[model samples]
Target: MDSLTQTIYECLFGAEYYEVNPASDDNTKAADVLRALFSANEGGEHLKKSVHDIVGERGWTENLAKAILGGIENALKQGAQMGKTMADASEKAIAEAVGFARDHPYFCALIAVGVLAILMPWVLEALGFAELGPVEGSFAAWWQSTYRGYVTKDSLFAFFQRLGMVWH
Candidate 1:
């Protein structure tokens, strides 16, 4: 293995180099090793340390070292900016949703009721208020038998009746 490839391998893996003939040129081999390290989900700090160690040992020209370091810094800055942008967007969306909910209380209440209606069966089952047994027959028969008691008219009427009492 070439000196550059050997140095990179040692810095990144903390071991001696093993020759793998994937690339003909030294630069390609080095690039391939770096790419593999990244693809393996190696942490950024480890990669940065390896690169710094490699640069120091290789005795490259000052300009080349500056260029490489500048590129890494730029990439880090862009990543931070992208993360900030996403966080700001999420905050804005949440604020808008809260504003809409506050402005349209009745509409929000209706939507909540609709969502609760859809999720009530699973909610009840999770809370041990409803128990579902293994399927025994056709889909229609199972659905009917499973939900009939939980979703009957008396239960819904009682729920709304209680809700009305709470309002009064």
Candidate 2:
């Protein structure tokens, strides 16, 4: 078996077990070690303890430990770079959207009005101002009747009077 696999076997199963077994094939040894680690009762706890022992007993050299740490640091740096790239892309998209809206105020206003018109009935129903009941004819006829009922000259005058009061 390889030195790393031998060390792992010794760490998990003890030196006696490693010497007694002496597996010729590295793959078979590794699989056997995996089976022993997972199939045992309290396997997770055993695995944790074995890993602690392996580190504490200096199963790996200083250079090997440093290499593992370097790999982790590199992975973290790459993740941070990826996050920065995504943030920059999102900022660019938002800036473009704002620029478009600023350059086409009339178009934006028309779009807003269209959206409001489509949502008016649902808004009115939600506010307990009207019910979306069965219509006699088309949707346009129903909307016209509903609009006339709520938007009379008296209501318009009342609204303007309230606005004037607010301004004053």
Candidate 3:
């Protein structure tokens, strides 16, 4: 029953499932309270104050408590289901994306080029390649300027022309 209570504590408060960190006062108190209420071995009366404090609180009705427990149980189940669904879909989507990229090299290349056109400036500045000024324009205008500026440069004109051939 302590295990069940600990699971409930974790599900409700995002506490660590097993190890109750002694370093954290809140974790210790939470662990103690759970043990006080639910431990079959040596608890409850051991912290007589805690049990009294809980029972003394208003609206400690059995029906309300049961309802709250049901809600928590439902939420944990729904969260698990959502996580599993996302995991399954993401695996399939990534596999399909990899296959598509392999089959359509040119299309993938274009996407890469377009992404680089938009992101290169930020990446360059972040990596200390260039000291870029703050950009002030609509994102579309910024992307167009960045793309045209880089492609038209003497350093990369030949590379841009090769990419243009793929576009043509």
Scored against the true structure, residue 112 in model 1 reaches a CA lDDT of 74
- Per-candidate TM equals 0.25, 0.25, 0.25
| C-alpha RMSD values across all candidates | 18.0, 23.2, 16.5
lDDT of 3 at 143: 46
Write down the worst ten-residue block by lDDT for model 1.
126-135
- The global Cα lDDT (0 to 1) of model 3 is 0.46
Model 3 TM-score, all chains together: 0.25
lDDT measured at residue 102 in model 1 versus the true structure, 0 to 100:
100
lDDT of 3 by residue, 103-146 (tens): 99977876775576455534423322222332345333354466
lDDT, candidate 3, at 152: 45
Query: What are the runs in model 1 whose C-alpha is more than 4 Å off?
Result: 1-82, 121-168
Q: Residue by residue across 78-168, what tens digits does model 2's lDDT show?
A: 4422334334554587799899999998667656644643555343233222223322464433544666656554543233223323331
lDDT of 1 by residue, 89-119 (tens): 5458779999999999977865675465465
Which residue window of length 10 is worst by lDDT in model 2? 159-168
Residue pairs whose backbone atoms clash in candidate 2: none
